[model samples]
Structure formats: structure tokens, C-alpha cells
Target: MIKGMGLSLIDSLDTMLIMNLTNYYKHARDYLAETLSWDRDIIVSVFETNIRCVGGLLAAYDMTQDEFFLKSAVDLGDRLLNAFQTPTGLPRTTVNLKTGAATNPSWTQQSSLLAEIGTLQIEFSYLSYASKQPRFAQKAMAVYDHLLTLMPEDKLLPIFINPDDGKPKGTDLVSVGALGDSYFEYLFKYWLITKKASRWGKEYFETVESILNTLAFKIVDQDEEMWYIAERQNKNINHKFDHLACFFGGLLALDAQHAPTEQMRERHMEIGKGIGAFCRKMYTMNPTRLPCDFVNIVGNTISNPIAAGKGWLMRPEAVETWFILYRLTNDTKYQEWGWDYFEAIEKYTKKEYGYTGLRDVTDSQKLEPDDVQQSYFLAETLKYLFLLFSPKDTIPLDKFVFNTEAHPLSFFEAQ
Candidate 1:
């Protein structure tokens, strides 16, 4: 384990404040002030550090007017700036906190995943504004500027790109899943976070059009038609759907609100609902009511399903979309689906200390635990669940935009 910072604790601070766990919030704040240190020599995932620690701290600082949170965020942001010291301004995958040394992960020998390199914009842009450090935003925007030159005419960027030369690695595969989900996500969010004053808004609209024309498809299952987005390899389409891609539904709905025309808004919402419904169906296909990490869909048939080995990772993307859809449309059906999903999670995965993942979501009689509860479980999953039930005024969508990690940074500075 790379023990660089108090990731879980820092990530959950805003949640504690939102949930009004006053005692817990105070204790977490004190722990950060009294115990947490950023001087340790540990290698950390640059993406994770930015989204959870930087995003969470900034959200808390905005909410509570706490200088400690801002100070902590700035300190961490200063250290993470080391990762962007590359020829192309695309950051390495990992960096040493104390030594200012950086490198890509082993899986990618000389390239960085699209999502990792592109997802830092929202966090860094906010950081620059909050700290008056324009360098953070400049570095973040430099990556986007370089990517614009390399983005294909179809707008389907390859999943991997060389960090040093700013070129797409020779890969035919394109996905909005593990390696590339949030790159597309941040395009729209960055625009909204700037209150639609940034040029990225135009890019967001164009990319969505490209996605609809190229990557989206519908299939009939059990006499019910549903939409699912697919990835592409050269000219061939892969019907394998990723649980992570479930976030597309909420994204489409959110993006729809900012659509230039009412007709475009209606069309986007219609497709968003279709995608959300199909994702909910994935959970119901199994006995335990949890989705697999990935599934292959062939024509109208799902085949060679593999949930036994990898299992569920307590993903929140589907639920996150449902919450956003409910808020946007005032639809009770989305809330109902979220409640049903939560009940299944409570019955099957709840543990004494915390919830665990499932090794076999298909087996209700013997549900095996995967023993890995990701940080997003607390940061995104539970936060979305809570907001799913709370009134719209809790964290108004117009006033805030969430990072991929679900940390809500306000559109206006803290008053």
C-alpha cells in the first residue's frame, strides 16, 4: 500500500459535513490538522490524489470556510505539480510525494491512459482559482490543448497516448470505460464549473454528437429494447459493456440541460433514460441484484458472462446517473430503482465494519465477499445514495458541479 496521504479520511470529510455528522466531521478535521503530513516519501496515483484529496479538500474548504482544508489542498497540489513536468505537459501516472520524482505505471511502458491524463482539469482549474496559482490551471489546460491537435476527426480518441511526444499510441481500441471514461466526462464538467464561460463547452457538445453518431447502439433483450454504448476497435464494434460506463446516463442528462436547443435537450434526455434503464437491468439479471464488472452482449444474447473471478467492485456509476436523472426530471421511477438497488446491497453486501463487494452476484444462496471496499464506496456511492433521497435543495445542481469522485465544488466561491 502506498501510504502517501490520508486518502479515505480526506475524501470523506466533505461527506461528513454534508451528512451533518458534526462530531465525525470535527474529528476528521482535527486529524488532518494534527496528524496528516505530506512530507512522506511515498508514490501515489496522480489521478486518485487529485480527484479525492484535492477535490474533497476544496469542496470542504468552500463549504466551511476552513483555511486548514485550503492549505492542505494547496500543499498537496504543489507536490502533484511535479507529475506534469514532461515535454508534452501530460502527467505521469504516478509520482513520489516528497522527492518530486514521477513516472508512468508498469502496465503502460511509455504512455498514459487517456482518462488519467485528461481528468485533472477540473481539480487543477479549481485549485488555480482558489490558490491564485495560475500555473496549475495552465498546466492542466496545456494537456487539453495538446490533445486537441491529436483528437481524430471522428472524436474517438484512442485509449492510450504517449506522454512525451503528445501522440496517440498505435491502438485501434476506443472506450468510455476504464481507460477513457472521465476524459469525456471532464470535458463537459469543466465547462459547467466555469459557469459556461470556458471554450470546453463547445468541445463537449461536438464530442457528444460524435458519440451518438459513432459509438451508441440499441439492442432488444427479453422483448424489451434498451440502449447501451459500445467501444470500437478499428472498424469493428465490441458489444462488451462496462459497469464503469454506466455514468454516461447522468452525463447525458446533465449535458442535456446545457444543450443549445430544446429539441436537442429532449433527444439527449430520451437516450439517457434508455441507457439508465438498461444498466438497471444488468443488476436484475443476476440473483443478488448487483452488476458484474463487465459483460459481453452478442446480438440480443449475453454470453460467457464472467462475474465469478473479478466480481463487483461496489461501483456507483449506475446509481449516480439515477440520482442525477431523478433530480433533473422529478421522476419517481429513478428514486424507486435506486432504493431497490440499495436494499439489495444492504441484504447481500453489508458487513459489521463496512460493506464488502461480491465475488458471485449470481448466487443468492451463498454470496461470497470480495473483501475490497473501494474509497469511492464512501466518496461517491453513499453520497449519491444519500442525495438520491434528500430534497433537491441539499446540494443544488445549478450551484455545484461534481468531480468524477463526486466531490461537489460550488460554482460560486464560498461566501
Candidate 2:
């Protein structure tokens, strides 16, 4: 957990940078430099380290113009490269810090999650660009090339892929949720960071259109139209949505403003608003103004059909979407909704140690706390909420693009 706090500190610094809190900036920078120096041999999970450590270092360097941060990022990037030593170039999930040994966990069945492999490109590519080490980006982009070769008939990728051979696992499952979320996210983000001239931009555009045509569906018989993207396995559609998947609405909204054609732009805007409304229901339908980890859409309404996993984990996707929609439309309704959501979290989840996950959001009387706060609660959830209420000039949407983890990266102009 201490290792993960590097991301939180960097995110706090980002907020400070935007607010021009120079005093706080110096404190943060000092603390970050100190933190980066501690425990050089602490083994780290690739995904966690990449998103937080590598991503944080890059963002910090960008904000501070500090060579120390960039040097640390390059060092971390070199250590992380050991995970990519597999035959097919899809990295293992974890790596040792000192020994540089890497391996997938025994339970993973020779396959890695799509999000794990696909999400590395943005940070790794940026590291390559900044550090002038082409190998980092080359290793990362190899995973993308391998995934393209294994694209399904529908062109949307499954959640798991064999790292050894770069093929989709036996399961036909496809989702924009947990195991799949950041794959699509980095696609668009990589395009933006690379200035839209790279293949990533074209892939992002194509994938969004494919998802709209294939994976996205509408809940039937609802008074107001609610569009929900679902997972498919072996021709069976699981009419469920995850809070994490809610990020798509905001992504769609952001992309809509940049769509090439007026028709395409309007279509994206419509989908974004529809998805945003559906996600809002995930909160308004609950007494606690918080959603379970996942919810089912059946016939006419969204339902918590699965009782076992009904919990809220301080996730930011829904609120993140609200922030983007609010930014795009300047609609006070999004702000109102966000404020209400924040109030509920403050009322229920706040604790002496830190905010925690809720075991059940529906039972307002006995909101059992899960007793752990994830780093993303700071890096993403609160950050998005803070940005939502801050002045528009702070991290102007036109000037920067955010990673899946909410770390902002400036657009790269090709030389």
C-alpha cells in the first residue's frame, strides 16, 4: 500500500499544480523524491507499478520538469521490461525488482488479462519518447500487434489472452469492464498522446464504431432509453454492467467533441448521454447513492439480481463520466448529481483510517464497511470529483489527455 501511495502523491501534486499551490508543490516533490528512493528491491506487480509508479513518475516529470523523476521512471521501466521476456511479448503480471525475474501467478492458467497486456502502451510509449529508449515502446507495441492478429469476428477482443502464444483464451467472453476496461481506454489515449498520426488513433476510431454496432445494446421497455454495454460469451449475452465500465460514457463524450464528421460526432454524443443517464441510475436507484460492483439489466429495469456481490468499492468510473459530461455540456445536473454522490460517500464511507468499500449499498441501515481503501480512490475517484468542481481552466480538456488511471499526459506534437 505504501508503494501505491506514490500515485496518490503525484495525483495530489497534479491538483496542486492546477491550483498553482507552489508551496504544496515543493512539499509534494520532496516527498515524492524521497519515496522513490526507498526500497529499490521491493518486488512489484507489473500493472500496479506501471500505472502508479511509472505513470506517476512521467506525470511528475512533466509537471515539475525534473530530470530526477524522468530518470527514476526510466529505471523503473527497465526493470519492468523483464516481464515482457515471454515468447509472444505479452508481459507476465508480476516482476521482481532486484533480480529482474518475472512470472505469471500459478492461478492465471498461462493467460493474462487483456487489460493487463494492452494497457501498458501509453505509459511505456511515453517513457520511450521521454527517455529516448525506443525498446520500451517497441516491447509494448508488440502486444498491440499481437492482439490485432487475434481479433474476433466482431473485432472486439475477449477479456483474456494467452501470453505464450498471443491468442484469445478458450472463453469467448468480451467486456469493457474489469478484465477489459483499460485496453480500450489506452487505445484512445495512446492516439491522443501520439498526436493522432499513429495507427492507435485509427484503431481507436474503428474499435469505438465496432463496439457501438456490436457490443452495445438498449434495455427494453424502459420509459427513458438506457443504453448498456454488456459482456458476451458463446453467443450468450450477460445483461450486466460494472461501475468500472461506466468510464466509457465519459470517453465517448470526450471523443464526440473530436469526431471527424458532424454525423459521427452527434451519434457519439447521443450514446454518451444515454450511457451517462444509465450510469446515473446505478446511483439514484440505490438508497445509499452508491452502486454495487455490478448490476443486471433485465427487461425494463436495472436490477441487483445477483445478491452475493452487491458492494461499492469507491470506484470513480461513474463520477468520472459525470465530470466529463458536465465539462462538455456545462450541465448543472451533472454537478448536482456528483455533489449528491460525494455527500453519500462522505456520510457513509469516511473513517478514521480512511474511506472503505461498502458491503451492501442497498441496506442503508447496516452499511458494512469493507475496511480497505484503494489507491485509485485518490488517484481517480476524488481527483475526478475535484476536477468536476474546479474551474474549467484547470487541466483544460483541450490541452491534455488522461490515462485510464486519470494521470494527465500532454498531447505529443510530432517533430
Candidate 3:
């Protein structure tokens, strides 16, 4: 057919990047070895690699007629599915790239109480879509089941949950407030993908609806900003919510899709806008030209009196506004803002040890890398920036890659 033409020279080059990027599979097994010292590299390879695989495989499947690329993506999907298995049903945050064993543990791994929970959904969904396998969906469903039972007493998800024991770990309602939307995003997304209309999804939707309704009316200050009320026991933390609270934009978009009222999506867009506006105000009000992490402090207020302010580099989520603005407007301003934010970070923060020195003002210009450089930062940061800066006509990332697990999940789609 004349409709299909020969590939351009650029296609070949892009293919090479995909191929070479993926060629590290053999080394993935030894990810924990000292040789691959950059935690980001190992995390990117074993865990975060899913984003690229999904991107490459999905892109190749849709645009190119390359069977090898598609099959390779499918094979990677299968390997990831197998790697994610755990007796407790909760997957580890970090795993030994080579040995297929659990390595480091972040509380976020279990409770995810946020979008981090969607890791399996993305992997399996891509596998299912790319390879047409039902097994991937089935594997992902198991994770949903496991995560559901781990919810805290108030129905509010915690910042962290213990992976091994299936219990709460640290910082009850602190880090990932997006855990709320994250759970709903995958639940509803799975429903859409499989057309199964899961009852679990129905229940989750109902609960999330109630929470959103409550958050809509509740205000911490006159600023008219709504935050997920952090619960210590029976009381509210009343701290100002950070936009990067967890999967805020993407999950909100997913929820907006299923909202019974059109106002829901509009409200979400408004929230996204508000975050940017607030950032602008903060820059002006502080007179420091530095972005504020969050408003209000609660609980014990550890190293920093500001509950959310670990520092400029510590806030992986400050970019939430940037991501949301771009998502809402599809304009370069947001992307430019994102780039500006990164530049400020690069200017004020230095990469040390492995982290971007969570505390910029406190580092005394000395480097004390992050205890955990956090794959989440790169996974979210690069994907958002890439989509923002990249050509919108050819590729617009409504969903970005988060992580890659080692297992053969192509079977999920096939089934």
C-alpha cells in the first residue's frame, strides 16, 4: 500500500538508542554489585526500566513495523512480571538487578497509598497491550488486592507501609498524599483496559469520591487550597499540602475521567493552576527567589520545622505544578517553568553522594548526597520534562514510564 512508506533515517537512529539502552539486560542481574554503583543506574535498569520499555515497545508497535522491537518489549514485560512476585503480594521498592532478590526498602514500596502502587498496572497494561496477554493484567490485579488490605484504619493511606510484614512503617500521612489518587488511577484504568468493572474498583471509587468531596470543602487557610488531611490517630495534621504529594497530576487526570460531574476535571485543572500560582507567590513573598516546599508543619517536625521542606533538592514533588500546568495547557510555559525549576535546583543544589542534597540552604555548599537518590525523582522528572519539551504531534505522554521489573509478563496480555 502506498499509505505505508519506508522508514526515515531518524527512525533507525532512534531504534539504535532503544536497542542499546535495552542491551543492558545481562548486566541487570548484577545490579546490586559494586560495579554498578550508581543506584540510579541499577534502579533505572531493573525497576525504573519499565518506563523506557513501555515507551520503546509501545512506540515501535505503533509507529514502526519492527517485529523484533515489539517482541523484545514483550519479553521484557514477561521478565518484569516474574520479578515482581512476592509472597506477601507487595513488591519491593528496590531489587537486586542480577540475583532477582529484594535489596533496599523504602516505606513507599508497600503502602504506596499513592500512585507508586500503579507500577504493576503500567507494566502489565503495556505488556497486555503490546503482546495481547491476559496474564499481565492478572498479575497486576494481585497487587491491587494486596495493597487494598493494607489500608489504614481511617481509610486514608499512609506515607509508608512495611513490605515484608504488611504493616505501617514510618510517617503515617506525610510523604505521598497522592497515594489516594494513585490507587484510584490504576483501579479505574484497569477497569477501562480489561472492561472487567471490578467490584474492588467500584468500592475504591466510592471511597475516593467521598474523600474528594470532603477535601473540596475543607480549607486549611484563607488561600482556598485543599489538602489531604494527614491523620496521626484521630486528629488532622492540618499542614499545607505539597503538589508533589504523590501522582497528583496523572492520578487526578484519571479520576477526572471517571468523575460523575464535569466540574471534577475542571476542579482538578484549577488545583493544578493554583499550585503554580502559589509557587509564584511564594517566590515573591519569600524574597529569596527560592521555591517553598510546603506550608505548615505538623507531627514531630524532625530535622526541618517545615514538615515537607527537606530542602530544594529534597522536594522531588515541587515540579508537580510544572507538570500539571503543562498537562492543563499543553504550552511551553510550563515546560519552560520546569526547566527553570531544574536550573534553580542545579544552581542552588549540588549532586553529592548520590542525591541532589535534599537540603540546599543547609548543605553549606558541601555535598551530602541523598541517603537514597530515589528512582522516583528521575522516573517522574525526566518523563515530564521530555514530554513537555518533545514534539507534541508525534508523542504526547498521558502516562509516563515509572519502573521496570524483571519477569515475563507478556503472558498477561496473551491470556
Candidate lDDT (C-alpha), each: 0.86, 0.82, 0.45
How much is the lDDT of residue 151 in candidate 3?
59
Top TM-score hit = 1
Candidate 1 on 221-328: residue-level lDDT in tens?
777767778888877888888889999989999999999889879878888888888888888888878888877887776543653434778999999999999999
Q: Between candidates 1 and 2, which one is better according to lDDT?
A: 1
Task: Using lDDT, rank the candidates from best to worst.
Answer: 1, 2, 3
**Superposed Cα RMSD, model 2:** 2.1
Model 1 CA deviation exceeding 4 Å by range: 1-4, 222-224, 307-310, 412-415
Q: Per-residue lDDT for 6-121 in model 3, tens only?
A: 11211222333333445442233223122312112233223344544444344444444456556655655555553456655555555443345543344344332334445557
Per-residue lDDT, model 2, residue 246, is 94
The deviation in Å at residue 410 for candidate 3 is: 16
**Model 2 lDDT at residue 225:** 73
* Poorest lDDT segment (10 consecutive residues) of candidate 2: 1-10
Local lDDT at 106 for model 3: 44
TM-score per candidate, in order?
0.96, 0.93, 0.60
RMSD of each: 2.0, 2.1, 9.3
